[model samples]
Target: MGIVRIGQTEITYDLRRSSTASERRITVTPGHVEVVALTSDDEAEIDAFLTRKRQWLFNALRELETTTAKRAVVLRFMTGSKIPYRGRMARLTVHRHGGPHIEISYRNGFLVDLPSWVGEEDQDAVVSSEIKLWLKRRVRRDVLEIASSYGRRFGLKPRSIRVADMKTGWGACGPAGSILINWTLVFAPKAVLEYVVVHELAHLSVRSHGPDFWMYMAKLMPDFARSKGWLDQNQGSMNADLFTSTRPIIDAT
Candidate 1:
């Protein structure tokens, strides 16, 4: 019975059969809510099942709606906006320079230097790109360092770690040893970033969400709870920044 709903609205789903009955599960992800049916269940039965779980479905959709509304408020880099990078808040200040160089240096705080070669309107784009590139390298280095140290300790090494602008989770590990992390992790604290890395690395040892997985995660990081607390408080803000990236216009001016 493949059926899903967003609040009271029923979502269109393509029903299909699965090999195992236990695999018939419903997932309410930030991307979308989906239901997987394993056997040839009756349409009426499926509808009834969905009806029974309507409250849970409504709640999930409501939460998603709230998240969407909150994310709509973009966190763009203004002249005085305090943006956090690598656990420290950096105040943004624009400087018009003669040379074609967009430099980001910590003076009294984070100063984004924009070349006068670019137009005033284009300053945001230039600054955004420079910040993203700088932060991207920063996050990549930190992830590599943290992942490597843990890999050596836990005897679980990832084939590769990738950082990208993902709208969903902080990090994800596929069946392969490949780890995909959100580059926006640069905006988060060190502990939050490490938690995401550890969470994904643990998937290499335990593929499924079972006792073994939790045990492995605990064995590697004793302060998982604290890490999660930091993530929970910061994840929303981190995710909120992705929306702001679209506001910066990048074009030859």
Candidate 2:
């Protein structure tokens, strides 16, 4: 780790020199900067390389800091914590009773009853797991119903529709007309969830996302853009990570 002044800004960077690295690169994250250079390159060379990338690093760091700050709405699974479902926020109410099963009922948000044996220390994990399962099951049923309804009308039937715990993408259509959707979409608004289902179903007809494909989307759902925009704007809060980490960047040449 070293401190170097890049123009008007003072920058702190963790520099690692690798013999196998073919070229130099810099990574910018919310916390700090990381620079990778050649093992044979001297301090001057590294400094020059960093100087060339000074502006990009500053811009990337500023943008990432702002985004991380705005999206750090990590709400743990606890009573009174507002959780999103079907495009609305629900309040969680929890209770412990004499039973082995985890009972859940949704009046406005959610009401839960856990076994008396469970202690306070285990409440968060237990609640998170049970609610996630409940949401996944509901999402699966809805996905199947929507897929079936759309399939009947569009004449495009999928061999299988599965809900998966995917982290990156929302949904995908594989060979043999199989559609896999991320289970996390259960937290999205119901209309947004339907948009994802119909989107994949359309893929059974059109392979790539060309004009004809969008034409199909428009015919199926006239106002899909609103849902898509909602997902786009709130994708950062889809996960409940409390702290920022350095994600891998596209290596700069």
Candidate 3:
């Protein structure tokens, strides 16, 4: 690991050599930063590349820190803890019942009932699992319907729409017309979620994010830029993975 100073912020990042990398790239996750460069590159060359992008690194680090702070409340998985659901905060209530199965339900809040035999250390994991399952069901019941309505309005029909835990992005559209949307989006406002659906559907008509694509998106959703900006600012707080170990179920390809 190496430390780089970007303005007033000091970033500690790990450097990884990738044989297939043609150019250096920087990735910022929830915790730290990563620099990926060609295996043949030396330390000095990497440092020079980082120096050139100091401003960008500094801004990203600030945004990440702000996002993490906003999400700290939901990260704790205990009774009375709050989690986001449909743009609102839902309180969690854990109950121990005499059964081998764990049951979860949601209304204004989440009710989790686990087997009495389950240890305290394991309850958090069980709660996360149950919440994920509930989110998946909501995706099937609600998000798909919303996506279809937008698709119809845009005269675009995707071959399939699947919900999964997309870590790096909100949604993706394949050449074959398959659309994969992140299930975590359930926590976002309805307008933001619609923006992502429309964005992916627009991809069906234009593969590249060129001027023509923006034109199409503007015609479909005039205020799309606002929704995109909202996602950029609040996405960190909406990350369900911060509380669980579930991976995205669909392949983007």
Best by TM-score: 2
In Å, residue 95's CA in model 1 sits off its true spot by 2.1
Worst 10 residues of 1 by lDDT: 244-253
lDDT of 2 at 186: 79
User: How many clashing residue pairs are found in candidate 2?
Assistant: 2
Q: Candidate 1 residues 33-56, lDDT tens each?
A: 456565776777667666766776
Give me the runs in candidate 2 sitting further than 4 Å from their true place. 1-76, 240-253
Using TM-score as the yardstick, the better of models 1 and 3 is 1
- Is candidate 1 or 2 superior in TM-score? 2
TM-scores for every predicted model: 0.63, 0.65, 0.61
Positional deviation of residue 29's Cα in model 3 after best superposition, in angstroms: 24
For each of the candidates, the C-alpha root-mean-square deviation to the true structure, in angstroms, is: 19.2, 13.4, 15.7
Tell me the lDDT of candidate 1: 0.71
Q: How many pairs of residues in model 1 come into backbone collision?
A: 0
* Candidate 3 lDDT trough over 10 residues, lowest sum: 244-253
| Model 1 steric clash pairs | none
lDDT of 3 by residue, 31-148 (tens): 5477887898898988888888787777776676676665443444568878788777889989899999988888789988888998864666778877878877886667688777
Candidate lDDT (C-alpha), each = 0.71, 0.79, 0.78
